[model samples]
Target: MSVSHLIKHSAITTGILSLASFGLAASPSQAVSVDFSSWDKLGDVYTQPGEASLSNDNANFQDDSPQASGYYNLSGNNPEEASPNPNLQDFLGLDAESLDDDGQAYEGSAIKSVITAQAGDKLSFEWRFSTNETSNKDFGFFLVNNNVIKLADFTNALQSGTSGSFQTNTGFNTFSYTFNSAGTYNLGFGVVDVGDYVTSSALDVKNGNLEEVPEPTTIVGSLILVSAGLLERSRKKARK
Candidate 1:
């Protein structure tokens, strides 16, 4: 081939390689599905440690760690003495207003699995309420991303929960998180508010679940380059 033709071919090949790289980056991240339903509650299974502070009457029934009960925990919580939301019972329409009513066990919740998603990727949750409250129980869910839950990020990523005491309650709350796809994150249950953050070694987290995005103009430029790559390739092949 002539020098000019060789140059043209070389440039086209480089462009193709560049476009493929961008496409791969734009692709979604791989996901890891974990199960902890059968995980055991690692503590004084029979004893309600935080009972007195939150409510001395906590767990009127079985309170062993759910892991001991033969189930995987999608999520779990071990509060440092905060009482189980009494509203959970009130919302149940049951006569009892708290888990303390029937004398149950207080098995700490568990997190069975984790998911890794990229920025702009929408990750959702399905909350299964296991509360015994038949009257006024209200449960909430929150996304603990890198341990940050400000109003801006919280509302942007996952459902924003109300802190403090609210008269309303629900069977379950489901929401989505718009991951920046940065460091790893752990999803937690229980009082999902500013103060609900708990530390645990057993929980699973996939790094880069919330990566921040490039500036708006940069993304637009990348898209334009991708489009141009496609158009140029088509033209060159047609002429060939």
Candidate 2:
């Protein structure tokens, strides 16, 4: 083979080898998870608009009067405390009315993203829903995969719940759903002032994550090695 042809062939083989190596090492299941402690500060994996623009905070929102607390937090109280009061349950619906009767109205905040995933991967988050409207006017936690809506619970309505009065409720209220197929999905999480911000419903969402389930390294490595051999054979043929 001519020197130019050899160089060209070598370059092609190198590219193929590189791609094969990458494909084996980088499995869709092994993609990094997107975790969020609070909406204000999303980690490197997540993306969101300005906090001010999106009221992803522990504030009351309504049409007549919008109460923007201008703060982003996972819960109204310390999550680590023994008797931690997840804001979602402590201050919504009947409880909200007791504080301020007139403040009852629709209040909510939503953040969404397009996540690429593989089968066996999971999307999970911890949330507490507090609402008097258990039937219709309730908290909604959803994941819109493609065009289908997957509810965190059996229904869109999430009733009032908490970790407990004294014990720290770690993993007390968690929502997790595994992906069935490999594809792009639009995942979202938020709290809405169902019915009214007063007859209010609150949702304390935190530790949101997309868990990645990657393929075994040995399998990936084996595939790469096989591809490399093919490339080597092609190089020999070119030389001949």
Please name the candidate that would achieve the greatest lDDT relative to the true structure: 2
Quote the lDDT for 174 in model 1.
44
lDDT of each: 0.32, 0.43
Q: What RMSD does model 2 have?
A: 13.0
Error at 166, model 2, angstroms? 16
Residue 5 Cα positional deviation in candidate 1, in Å, after optimal superposition: 12
Which regions of candidate 2 are displaced past 4 Å? 1-33, 37-107, 132-136, 146-171, 195-197, 216-240
Residue-level lDDT of model 1, residues 94-180, one tens digit each, is 222222312221223222124454456555443322222223222322335323221111212232224421112232334456766
Alpha-carbon lDDT of model 2: 0.43
Output the number of the TM-score-best candidate: 2
- Local accuracy of candidate 2 as per-residue lDDT tens digits, 1-240: 778667766775676666565554544444344544333322111233222111223332231223333223333421110012223223221232222212232344444556688788887765654333433333334535423232222143423344321111122367778889999876655444433333333344555667788666546666666667766776777767
